[model samples]
Target: MNYNLKYYKFGLAIMAVILTFLSCKDKVKNKVSNEEAAISTFTNPLKVEFGDPFVLDNGDGTFYMYGTGQVENGFATYSSNDLVNWKFEGRIYEGNIEASWTQKNFWAPEVYKFGAKYFLFFSADDKDNPNDELENFKIGVAVSDSPKGPFKDLTDQPLFDPGYPIIDANVFKDDDGKFYLYYSRVCYKHPVESEISQWAKEEGLYDEIEESWVYGVELAADFKSVIGEPQLLLRPPLEMNDRNAEWESRSVTSGEVNRRWTEGSFTFKHNGTYYMMYSANHYAGPNYAVGYATSNSPLGKYQKADNNPVLQKNIDKGGDVTGTGHNMVLSLNGGKKMYTMYHGRTKAMGENRVVFIDKMNIEEDGTLIVDGPTTESIPKPLEN
Candidate 1:
């Protein structure tokens, strides 16, 4: 055989081998991409009636969710691996106590896992003396051995002392792993001639005149009790008033100025800023809405979002959404996806509120913008 001819044949063989390897690599890449898309795209399997999301990542590709699960006077639990599709995990705790303080009306239940135990925090009022237990109205926690737990009362008594009227308990651990509990409390005074004053005499809101303020308590190393006083973090705007339009009964407040006060205190840090989202207006009324404030620190001197409320609607004006507020924020797939869970009433005569989850995004200024929830199914996180 001619040496030049043999060398040319060998070079051609090398080129063919290189082309084959490149083609195989491209096929593998395409396969992996398709697999990822399949995993990320998921169907919304959650059928919770109202929103007050309780989401936890259980590490094994499984995430647990507890959506407005109030079981027999105590909050319930539900689990999910994907952002969508949930399984009822059963009631985690039983509520009992005759303080004439935390009697009923179980509000928001926020849970956190600290070390080997699960701490469940929630709000309630014994309609007989709501404001009397101001500090007790704040947050309470129960501990359990497992994520899906029969959490037992840690203190065997109220975890917080009743001094300020607080509700909507949210527990967060910072990047450095320090534990803190954030919540909303009424810090403003009720109008002397308002119904609240009249109700105060009979029991309900207003045992004392105080406005709603969001505060953060530094938790002990065990994530149990407060180390110091819950710092005065955010206060409701001094100028808040019933901004309800005239057409809508002054008898029924609406619009912007109607004594807007913060209720739900949900905190999340993004882009080095702490954002607190809260609820306003009468929880049982159609005017219920959500607003947010931002600050540079978790324990903050929060500045109200220049835009005020990030979510609201005028169902009184012939709209679909009504009474949407009291929300919790959750992150999925290790922060690739964010969601807003909250509760809203669907009918005029009904207080049977239901929970809804919607996709949300953060603006450049550290404010959140939510798309709101719909009956239509949405894609899941890891499965998308």
Candidate 2:
């Protein structure tokens, strides 16, 4: 073959191969883009009637969710590899355990993995308490070797009772290897005669009603007991200037200003700043919403975020979702992204709460944003 002719043939062949590779790369890129577009959004109410939902990733490629209801005997959990679809894992905690202290009102179960063991922190009625039946709700701890657990009580009795009706316990482990417990202290008979209360009384609602406040305390290393006095982390705002007062005062609409609530505390630390996300107002009420406060310390003198009610009802926008509260945040994609898992009410279902998961973002200024209480579909959590 002539030298020039052979070189020309080689050049032609190389060009053909390069063109083919570019064509294939374009096809693959289009396929990925289309797949992402198709998954742009997921509908709200991820599951029917899963209230006070808490999601835990056990590093086993499965996310376990525990919440209120579905088991008369104890608490039930659901599992998902992806945030959208879930599989019922059946009852995790058996209220009928021979030595169980409480047999009823098992609510708001949060699971955490410490070392090789898993801990389930929750609230339930203290059957041994001889006080007014309505004030018997207390916090409890259970343990198991697996994430999907038949968790057994750490003790035969409720965790330390703060001499009040307490519920909605959430535990946080700080960077310093310290553990803290956050819970709601029910205000069954808390009184109010302030300006807000006077306005409520004029509205013809009850002058004195109940409220709930979120409290935090350091935990003993064993995680079975409290290490120090509980610190009042959040309470219903009494004055308008109270950063959270407007959203936290849902009770005032019914003339129960003093009965406002600030509960369901979940804390997350970012960039050395602590953010305590909490729910305010009655869980079943339309005004129930999620808000947060930030501090330099885990056990905080935290201040409410100026843009309060980070997540709440969007009904005014022609959405049917309401009573969105009791949220737990999950870090996904190796902490590249975050999500808020919470419960919301569907218009068709009235006060019955269902679990929903939506994207979350933290601003450069450390402001936490929950991209939800969303009634519209949203993208599922990205996988690793």
Number of the top-ranking candidate, with TM-score as the measure: 2
| Candidate 2 ranges beyond 4 A from true positions | 1-41, 96-98, 254-258
Q: Which digits, one per residue and each the tens of the lDDT, describe model 1 over residues 59-162?
A: 67766665455576776777765556667777876665543234565667766765677777877653445445533454567778887887776765456764
Work out how many backbone clashes candidate 1 has.
43
> Candidate 2: which pairs clash?
41-378, 42-378
Full-model lDDT, candidate 2: 0.83
Question: For model 2, how does the per-residue alpha-carbon lDDT over 1-384 read when each residue is reduced to its tens digit?
Answer: 599999999999999999999999999999999888767656777864688999899888888999998888688888887878899988888885568888577889999998999999998888776655766788999999998887989988888978788899988888888988899988776564555566676767766656677889999878778987999888776676666667787756744345777888899888888999998887777778888999988878989888888998898788888888899999877678999989988878876788888888998978788877666656667642
Model 1 per-residue lDDT at 66: 59
Q: Least lDDT summed over 10 consecutive residues: which range in candidate 1?
A: 244-253
What RMSD does each model have against the real structure? 9.9, 6.4
